[model samples]
Target: MTYDTVAETDPAVARALEGERERQNGTLSMIASENHVSEAVMEAQSSELTNNYAEGYPGSRYYGGCRYADEVEQLAIDRAKELWGADHVNVQPHSGSQANMGVYLAVLDPGDKILSLDLTHGGHLSHGHPANFAGQVYDVEQYEVDPETGYLDYEGLRETAEEFDPDVVVSGYSAYPREVDFERIQAAADAVDAYHLADIAHITGLVAAGVHESPVGVADFVTGSTHKTIRAGRGGIIMTSDEYADAIDKAVFPGTQGGPAMHNVAGKAVGFGEALQPEFTEYAEQTVANAKALGERLRSHGLELVSGGTDNHLVLVDLRSSHPDTTGKDVEEALEEAGIVLNANTVPGETRSAFNPSGIRAGTPALTARGFGENACREVADLIVDVIDDPDDEAVVAAVGERVTELTDEYTLYE
Candidate 1:
């Protein structure tokens, strides 16, 4: 992270860094799981915390000079616990995938069965993709979204859980548009005497900001990212019920990772602090407003939304019905060309490949935070629909791209 002496001779890196800043200023970042951290958080992340290893938690570190490190780590933990109302918080786990991995490691043996959401039907790769460790190390059973409604099949989940009798029942997703029925999932898990792990990585900010239901009180274990909707640094976080405290901490510390990233933890502390502020609540609310507005506008333009529209920060744009033969890859690349960035995602019953999916996933949290209101979100979605439905139209493309540049100018990133 050091560029202190690079400016003296390494002009190339400096130019590249400025180019990155320019990209942020111009491009519309619609990636659901991405956000730009604040200057305070960035400053803390690049601070002296990086200079120290501080292996081990708090005062029990192997390093001698870890008093301040302990302070920083504990500050993150306390603030996270307060924000999420959890019994225990581990600000380790590197990424959301690893956080869930540690949760599985804590309670389940290798080859133990876990009932989770299916990969293409809104589940995360970490939940149980065949290529991921979750699938290789554990017996992964899966549930799916309803084919007709494009929403959760609670009865299907219950039936699947009853049949599988898994050691753990996992709930959460990267593409689901509706609010999760955590209570129903919990009841099903309880019926089968299974533990429940809710991966709230995508909705952490919503939950923390009180826009969505908190999974902390209901799930036995909850895993999330400090980034994404949480809008913190790029790191995974693990929280547990008091009964599983020791096991969860051990799983995260020795079983999964050795040393914690103190710098990231410091950034997490700043993020948690920001979340505690009243304005962060306003930011979180505006994120949802922008999302709902964008979804409505897109659907009005004849675009099909999986589950109709989103109740949260992200929406998955189903393209097959809207623009025939329009792959998610084309939509993504085309949008990027116009300086609007969003990821290609899989829609329910996606017959296409995962590499180039059938849908585009977009969110408004970052752009909204950048000062795009509901009106701006609606306009952006209208332009997006235009670009996707008619990419070959040069004049339309140019006009939309110009609006994007003008919009960002009024709500600048670094300004």
Candidate 2:
């Protein structure tokens, strides 16, 4: 992790890198869509494969000097297949969004209809948000979680699919904190004769470790980011049946992306190999258990949690009910000052702008990676509640920041 080589050429960038390392070591990262990858994975991502230009699939590359690139790419594909139990896996997409674009290009023509969850209700922008290309290219409609219950309204989703008659129905979410029933979503898609694209970007590790239900066989196309719960290199992956293998490969290669980042593919191979170990299952289980404990403790302090609690690694807290005057951004900044890092996220039935939303999203993936268990998560929750109660109180923030430093030191990382 030393930056001596970089320092020789660019001392400023090296200083920033060292500062980042220190920041991570000092802070608690509760961001749901993030995790700590192993140093082995990091090494692989910084390998010589970064210089390769393998334009096509293994055994049929469009460039020469790709022997090692071919080996690394095939290993990533094989390990991803083993992890997810897919008939075909594409490790080429630059990101989860690009993977979705690849799927769209494979099946849908311009102006084809898409039915997905509403953004404020825990959906991703790639799932047909107006700001993303998917919304502009396709005719899109959306479903929402039951505002009262804070859960997906399956019947409503089915009804929407029937009425919209979309070419594709997207399942899975970014901020939703429950086990997604891929079968139910698939049934909705089936009812409308629409393809089901399940984007499991946030919970890839949970699904791979069997802690959460997988969408590999249920959904027609599955996409995920490697760097989230999976803790691989920073990249995207697409999984599907062999029926659409050729189309998907072509769409990913010539349609959405060109040459793959083979270095990241190497990282995927290493991280996926690590996930296949028995300890990873325990890690995934602990992540969920920690989240539950965190949410329960937060609720005990009278903070309102969306859905009242969580079944996964993340919990969304609606500040409007308990802390009526507190915006998520206010709490977010206060928590950061206290050395706790998460995000201000929009909640279902949001009454404010996305930038300064009413909810704060927190998760346990990074904390779990740092060896945090239920007891530690509860303590973190207590600290968060303390900050939420008096965000502008300098003394309170300073006290919480000291406790955070102690916790971070107790559960050390990257050492």
Candidate 3:
């Protein structure tokens, strides 16, 4: 898409926009929570609905001239319900973090206890980090994965739930590589008479396509990001039974957020429509397969993966065992220079600071979106290893960059 209209108004911003588009076309995006949406979704997101304020649900907006807005929002809601099978769905919150905040506002009183995973152990800031509003308002305790196995310790979680007697137990994860047993977590929440909020923010599409176990019926509330595995535009979604529908709607509208982003809701409608197609199932399945291929190749090259391998679309590599002196930041920077982009994430039992952590996290959603298969993913893994093995070697970096250029060209994005 040309940015000529934007350039007419602001050349500087237009240039940056074009540069970002070029960068996405050039580099490999392996960030676990990122994806490339279809052009239709982008067009919907850039629609003129951005100027409208639809302050309420369909058929009950507080403003006039909301007929199209109502139609778009209702379509988004219907598609989300069909995708996730929830009795009630809220597609309002601006982001996944806002979705979590809406849930907190819906049920809990100030100072109520929350039990969630530790941030360094694959949890998100919205769950209960000190910097987030949830942490400031709630009494929070954290659980951890097993240090040795790098898997969630369900038995230990049960014990913690019993002892902490939290009001809400938060499941789901940001950087976790394994499939979560939402039923198991719900069982613990049930035993303690606490609510279970499964934040499937990262695996929404995988669950929708049945590649990953769903938390919809199992958990009290299910929240997700539409832009991750779902390949939708940027937005957050919350699903619950009809019993909590009104509470959630009120919390999202008059509680945590103002008017919804109608344009993004339109984008969601388009993206969700696309996901319901038969090919999306193939895409989801291929995403997981490619991740397994990438992880297997990385492990074969002597990198230590958290949990030994992946059950989903992401793999977290703990570098302490394989390269004690090389930090994730070092590898992250070198890999970016070589045109393969991913994030430096903290592993379970972390010994380094959060800024420059001990592990790297990579995923296959965007690559798979660009038609990369298992062999391509393995080759990408090899390139990653080459750079990590010799970050300072100019020749190695140059060679890897050349290969990345070929792959990006071979499986062209935004063409």
Q: For every model shown, what is its TM-score relative to the native structure?
A: 0.97, 0.99, 0.99
Each candidate structure's count of clashing pairs: 0, 0, 0
| Residue 410's lDDT in candidate 2 | 87
Write model 2 residue lDDT over 197-307, tens digit each, in one string. Answer: 999999999999999999999999999999989899889999999999999999999899889999999998999999999999999999999999999999999998989
lDDT of 3 at 315: 99
Kindly indicate the candidate among 1 and 3 with the higher lDDT.
3
Off by over 4 Å in 1: 1-4
Which ten residues in a row are the worst by lDDT in model 2? 406-415
Per-residue alpha-carbon lDDT of candidate 3 for residues 248-298, written as tens digits (9 for 90 to 100): 999999998889999999999999999999999999999999999999999
Superposed model 3: Cα runs more than 4 Å off: none
Cα lDDT tens digits, model 1, 225-317, are: 898887776799999888998898899889999888889889999999999999989999999999999999999988999999998999998
Colliding residue pairs in candidate 3: none
